[model samples]
Target: MAFLAQFRAAPNLLTMVRLFTIPFIVIEILDGNFGVAFALFILAGISDGFDGLLARWLDQKTTLGLYLDPIADKLLLSTLFLVLTHVGIIPRYVTVLVFSRDFGILLIATLLFATHTLRDFRPSLFGKLNTLVQIVALLTILGEKAFSSHQFTTLNATLVRSIAFLAPLSAAQYAWIVIQRLHSAEDPPRRSAPKTGLAQISAVEGADPSGSTDRVAS
Candidate 1:
């Protein structure tokens, strides 16, 4: 489906705008301009939250929007984590652990999806907790650099270490839930919705090739 179908949707537009900010944020970080980067990061975060809320409020959820929103988020966070590691702000070991967890989950999800085992895409509790801490870690790093505060430095180190502990736990949590869902043999089978005679007639009449409801002479 064309993005134009949902290009006007406020939520999707915010998502697109968030993706667009990535490069500028990267530029700021590379140039040692943490202040501007922090500002931009906050902007992206706001857009992320606002987009979802606006989507619900406006009743404008589309398939494209549903997929696009998460892609944008993963791209932003993953890219920043990689870049921060590159610049020596985040520890290499922490980044390695984080990347491993992310890729492992992605791989499992892809395999399951390809095999048609699971259709519902839901976030696990630990997964959301991991994301929350990551956001805090990123903000702490940016704030430390931008403001040169001892408190920010301590907070950043704490958050990074917490992620080191939490990321893999979160990944395992997701894996466990997915495995349970896949092997739910005892669950009752899903029955298809009944299509009654009236529904069939209504469908045919509404989809008449001639596009006419009135009777016509032969």
Candidate 2:
């Protein structure tokens, strides 16, 4: 019962709700209802930001929250990228880059988990920046389509190109960091000398059995 109290916290509940909304947002976007889709997307984003703030302010942070937050962000953003690209609002190249980077990251993460090489690797700054660009691109695309604004369309196109270029660059940076960390972990520290207190005895034994007594006496 004591443990159950932790799960009932406000932030955790909000995070859970955000996860639940991902599929609904995807469905609405696919149905060609940009208005409701945009609304749900905004709601999801707000919930995401609010939950983090709530967790920090109310001291309701949890291990589950840490894991769920990133997963929810990835799932929601990835789905939007795919759906919007499929419908021609988002450029195909942008979606391709986003998906490729995400796929690469997931693959590396899986390999690390399987090999027990990584226990905890938080998102890098580059990765977070990529996500922010993606979110902005998605919102701009949706906005342009919904409101029919030329200015927004131009901005959307610019964001799409920027995201396409940055996605792979940021992904490669993350991969390099992971590889360096993995190598550091795998290569254990080298000792300058055998750390045994019986080194003299072993040396004497190697030299001559009779020398053991002399070495001990000395």
Candidate 3:
């Protein structure tokens, strides 16, 4: 009951709605109904934004949401990338790069969690930008197909190239951050020097009822 209760939040329900749209979007894409797919994709994007906004506005953020939100985003985006690649809409290399980075990060995160090395899995700025680039690229492709325009060709190419660049760059940045955090976690704490007799006397005099003066003892 408690677990299901977490999904009762409006933000989480919105996320669920987004997840439900994925299959329909996939079906539309597979059937080459680009216009319908584009509309569903747009709806998914809107729901993604509103879920976050509702979470903050309503104070309905939950731990389940923290995990569910990103998972939903990744599943929808990754699946679309694969499906689009199959249809030759998105280049295979772009999907490969995206998948490689995501898979590598997932492996690293799992290993770190199992070993209890570091648990902070916050996405870096570059990672966020990479996701944004991917979203725009997909939108461009779908819009081009739905509207039957040649103008999108140049912009779509640019967005694809941007994804190629940002994917690896973001992965490298994430690795560097993880390495720094691991080093920080492993580094020993610096010990303070022992207080001199006079300093000890002063500390004792200033001690609180809880005997926090011990903190100054070294």
Candidate 4:
């Protein structure tokens, strides 16, 4: 089902802009342009925040946006983590955990999508917190280099350790949720009717931008 009217919505446009900025951000970081890269990272985050808020405010959420937003986030963060590791900014072990958790979730999601066992991607709280911590960690690393702040050095260490633990736990949580879902599939359907638009929108609004949902967009 296509929502053509929402295709050109401001939020979707902002999301695309965020995706587009990824390559440039990577290039800046690679070239040792820490200040430039850090600024771009902030810009990307701002765009990310506004895109979802605008989607809801404008009442213009689209399935495309729902999927595109998270894809952009994962691509950018994952790519940055790898690049930063290459330059010895983020530790190799932390990068490994980040990639492992993301790929594990992606692999499961792919299997579910292939078998038609999953519908919308509901992001667990663990995944959202993991992503947030990862972002802060990235920013701290970038900012510390950009300004050589001793404070950021300590902050980066703490954030990296936080992500180290959170990443695997988040992956395990998603796996458990999927297992519960698969088991629940054996049960009979509910007597209640399908959800209404208002409820769907509310769920989407309240939903963290971590994964797909049970209901696709109208």
**Candidate with maximal TM-score:** 3
lDDT of each: 0.87, 0.81, 0.92, 0.88
Off-target runs (Cα >4 Å) in candidate 2 are 1-7, 190-218
Candidate 2, residues 1-218: lDDT per residue as tens digits?
24567678888788788888878877877887777888888888899989989999998888777777888888889888888778777778888888889898899899889988897777788888878888888787777666766777667778888888889899989988998898998899987875354565567465434544444445
Model 1: ten consecutive residues of lowest lDDT: 207-216
- Write the residue-wise lDDT of candidate 3 on 1-218 in tens digits: 26788989999999999999999998999999999999999999999999999999999889889999999999999999999999988899999999999999999999999998888898999999999989999998999999898888999999999999999999999999999988988899999988777666666587644545645445
Candidate 4's C-alpha runs over 4 A off are: 1-7, 188-218
Rank ordering of all candidates by TM-score, starting from the highest? 3, 1, 4, 2
Can you give the lDDT of residue 195 in candidate 4?
A: 62
Write model 4 residue lDDT over 1-218, tens digit each, in one string.
35776558888899989999999988998899999999999999999999989988988788889888899999999999999999988889999998999888899999899889897679999999999999889988988888867887777889999999999999999999999988898788779667676665557576434544444456
Candidate 1's TM-score reads 0.82
RMSD of each: 11.2, 7.7, 4.8, 13.4
Query: In candidate 3, how many Å is residue 124 off?
Result: 1.3
Give per-residue CA lDDT, model 1, range 24-139, as digits (tens): 99999999999999999999999999999998999988887889998998889889998999999999999898889989988888887888877676989988988899998998
**Lowest summed-lDDT stretch of 10 residues in model 3?**
208-217
Clashing pairs in 4: 120-212, 120-213, 120-214, 121-211, 121-212, 121-213
Predicted structure 4, TM vs. truth: 0.81
